[model samples]
Target: MAFASVPNGNNIRNEDKVNEFLQNKSKSMAKVYLYMGIGLLVTALVSLGVGALFAGLFSNFNRVDTAYIAENALVAYITTMVISFIVLLVDGVVIARRAYSSKRSLWVPYIIYAVTMGVFLSTFLIAGIDFYTIGEAFGISGLAFFAMALIGYKSKANLNVLGMVASGFLFCLLIGSLFWGIFYLISPTLVYIFDIVASFAIMAFIMVMVAVDTYNIKRILANGCEGNVVLYCAFIMYSDFIAVFIRILYLLSALKDK
Candidate 1:
């Protein structure tokens, strides 16, 4: 994705301005990545701790009594997911009002969101995915994220148009999935297929979002926007990274089961 127009009408002919712009962009991007990394670390640690604490619940169930385990686990997972969703809503609100909110208020919701997500993600351990495979998926997700961010940073392409299109498509996908969930009992196999397709589609959408969001961040910085907006930017990128990681994990788990 390449655009012919230079952002902010930057004078590429002026050597000093060009250097200054590059330096500032680098510093801004570094902060974005640093915050994102911290968020990821927090999520990973909390997830691991939760998984360890609930190891007994996730293990040693007899195949003969599988029905009981499945029933209880499903209920627990669904409850956790609902709570996580609420946390996400609150987190979004915090991000939206971040400029006006105190630093403590902003940090509280962000931390809560990360911790809630970690608890939710620990449900994956119940699926019996080995640690090695889980680590591999994380590695792949990191590489994919880095590659997309680099492209977004270096590419001259305008992503505004693409972002709008992708957002619409994503909305449709969410609607379709909701309907699928409601009607899945009618055709479990077909719904499963759709779920797989939806997972991959979501992965692609989020990957594009990562690039678009990164480009937008750079554009904001280029325009001389300042303050604690970097926190909001990191939240956006961290969400993208987690989405991609979970999708890749789902794909890998599916393949492993096969």
Candidate 2:
């Protein structure tokens, strides 16, 4: 019995087409970071605004009870951290679903970005933290982030290998920070030493990841992977920015206490 033979040419041609499309898409994906960078700027501005508002409130009140301020600070920190975490989870789910179903990512991350800034601002406002030091923190984070991103996007070197190491270090830092805090050993010098190192490492890692992901997004777009790529890209970008901000805050707070 003669079996019907299908020409493999069609399959081969289809794949070539897909590959070509992905190549073009990768270029497009790279441009998304431009928007992502803008989002970071927006977040920073909002955060600063929040800090300013809090500073003004506390400065005008002129109630300089260190104990009262510290207690309020603790509450603010706890509240913001809790709320930011919840927002992150919710945003992740929403973005993930869209990314999986469609190639186009959504802009829901912008909302998360805004809310995260708000939380941080609230922490300072409620705690009566020093805005001048907070401003220093914001500046440090922003500069480092931009520098790393520029290097990552421009450099010919591949940074994919660093992600694993960076993540491991970050995990250790988290554990150490928690344990040390429990023991009331979270001093300025210790924080400065640990945070400066950790922030540098994370900044490098995030740059590499952002570059790699940007390339991936471009490829997906070229392949006509359309639906939620925007959202996914935004989500990833915001997460990186948040990581940078947190590290900056740690370092800044440490310095201020000194």
Instruction: Give the candidate number with the greatest lDDT.
Output: 1
What tens-digit string does per-residue lDDT give for candidate 1 at 183-232? 68788888988878888788888888888988888887786444467667
Question: What's the lDDT for residue 146 in model 1?
Answer: 87
The whole-model C-alpha lDDT of candidate 1 against the native structure comes to: 0.78
Cα-based RMSD of candidate 2 = 8.9
Give the least accurate 10-residue stretch of model 2, judged by summed lDDT: 213-222
Clashing pairs in 1: 3-157
- Cα deviation of 47 in candidate 2 (Å)? 3.8
Measured with C-alpha atoms, the lDDT of residue 240 in candidate 1 is: 89
At residue 231, candidate 1 shows an lDDT of 66
Could you tell me every candidate's TM-score relative to the true structure? 0.76, 0.58
Best by TM-score: 1
